[model samples]
Target: MLSFNILYSQERNVYDENIFVNCQNEKLNWKKLELNSTEYKYTLISKNYFASDKDVNYYNGLIILPIDKNEENKNVIEELLKLISIEEDLFEITAIKKCEIQKLYYSSFLTEEQKIEVKNNVIGKLRLGIKN
Candidate 1:
């Protein structure tokens, strides 16, 4: 997921965590939940404290990728950029991309421990920025 900040009326991607992918003029950030030799799983939140809004619920999702892969890998982030598109200045998955990713069962990608951490910690803080 990607967060956005409007600075001097120019939109930019702002993230609390370090960027995991930056390619083709697009940037993305994620939190690592699990890592191993073959692959790792992470969650990317489209919403941040400064960006809390109705879209939060829509754009949150998980991603799993091979550990051997890096930004230098051919079309690594590019393929991801295709899966998670930025719309209206915010990173969001279109219905088509969402369906494609959904088929991969990203939720099942996380282990039980990661699930608890995400629900208890991540979800609790998901919309903390929104005005009451």
Candidate 2:
């Protein structure tokens, strides 16, 4: 498991290099986002554990999740989202999206032709074909 370390120190507020994505068909990768000023790290710990593609269930806002059960990670997640703009070095130029996240997630980390599959997935481009 690669660590992005978006949160670091006791404050849990920092970024580390080589933050890889989870692109396996059986594993999931998650990230941070802010909605209604509430922070959430979109990890496989959400509600989409039993479904896929057309059968997948989105959050209350049509957002998909895998575990969706960590209430305490809210504010910390939001702060992580905010870190994108604060630290340009936090994430790749495309994946972070200037900190405007909407249902943030992606696949595993794989580098091909100098392009990362996970980064492409995060960018919402390239057809990895694996859905949900």
Candidate 3:
């Protein structure tokens, strides 16, 4: 069971990191902000992007939920999304796009070899979930 858990975690990490790399390629300027919460120590992967009008600055990204021993991924993500939606409504946010990437990278984090490695390792999964 322990080994299976470790394998699952590793796969998830690869998926997450591949998304991060793809975000960098798109010039989204992603950032990981620390949420001020007492219940969970989760990091928010946010990105600053311009709207179609180029007047309003929109923020969107994923909530990096911690691995809980008791809860499944689907449950945890759903609960977190609900909480975020409530907060967004309170704050009048326009939309919520769920995804994760750390730091606003104006430059590439992956080397030439590393890029090839990621492409080979998870070619099918290398996509940023953002639509615009």
Identify the candidate with maximal lDDT: 3
Q: Which stretches of candidate 3 lie above 4 Å from their native place?
A: 1-38, 54-56, 68-71, 88-132
Q: Give every collision pair in model 3.
A: 62-99
Tens digit per residue, CA lDDT, model 1, 12-72:
2222231122121233344333222323234444332344455432222223333333335
Better of 1 and 3 by TM-score: 3
lDDT per residue as tens, model 2, 12-54: 2221112332233334345665556855443322121222356
- Residues 1-132 of candidate 3 have per-residue lDDT tens digits of 000000012123343444455554442222222233535333333443324323333333333444332334445444543454444332222222332222222125555543443332211111112222
Select the stronger candidate by TM-score from 2 and 3: 3
The TM-score that candidate 2 achieves is: 0.21
True lDDT of residue 65, candidate 3: 40
Off by over 4 Å in 2: 1-69, 89-132
Model 1 TM-score is 0.25
- Clash counts for the predictions, in order: 0, 13, 1
Q: How well does candidate 3 score on lDDT at residue 40? A: 38
Ten-residue region with minimum lDDT total, candidate 2:
122-131
Alpha carbon lDDT of each predicted model = 0.29, 0.29, 0.33
Evaluated at residue 61, the lDDT of candidate 1 is: 25
lDDT of 2 at 44: 24
| Predicted candidate 1, C-alpha RMSD | 14.2
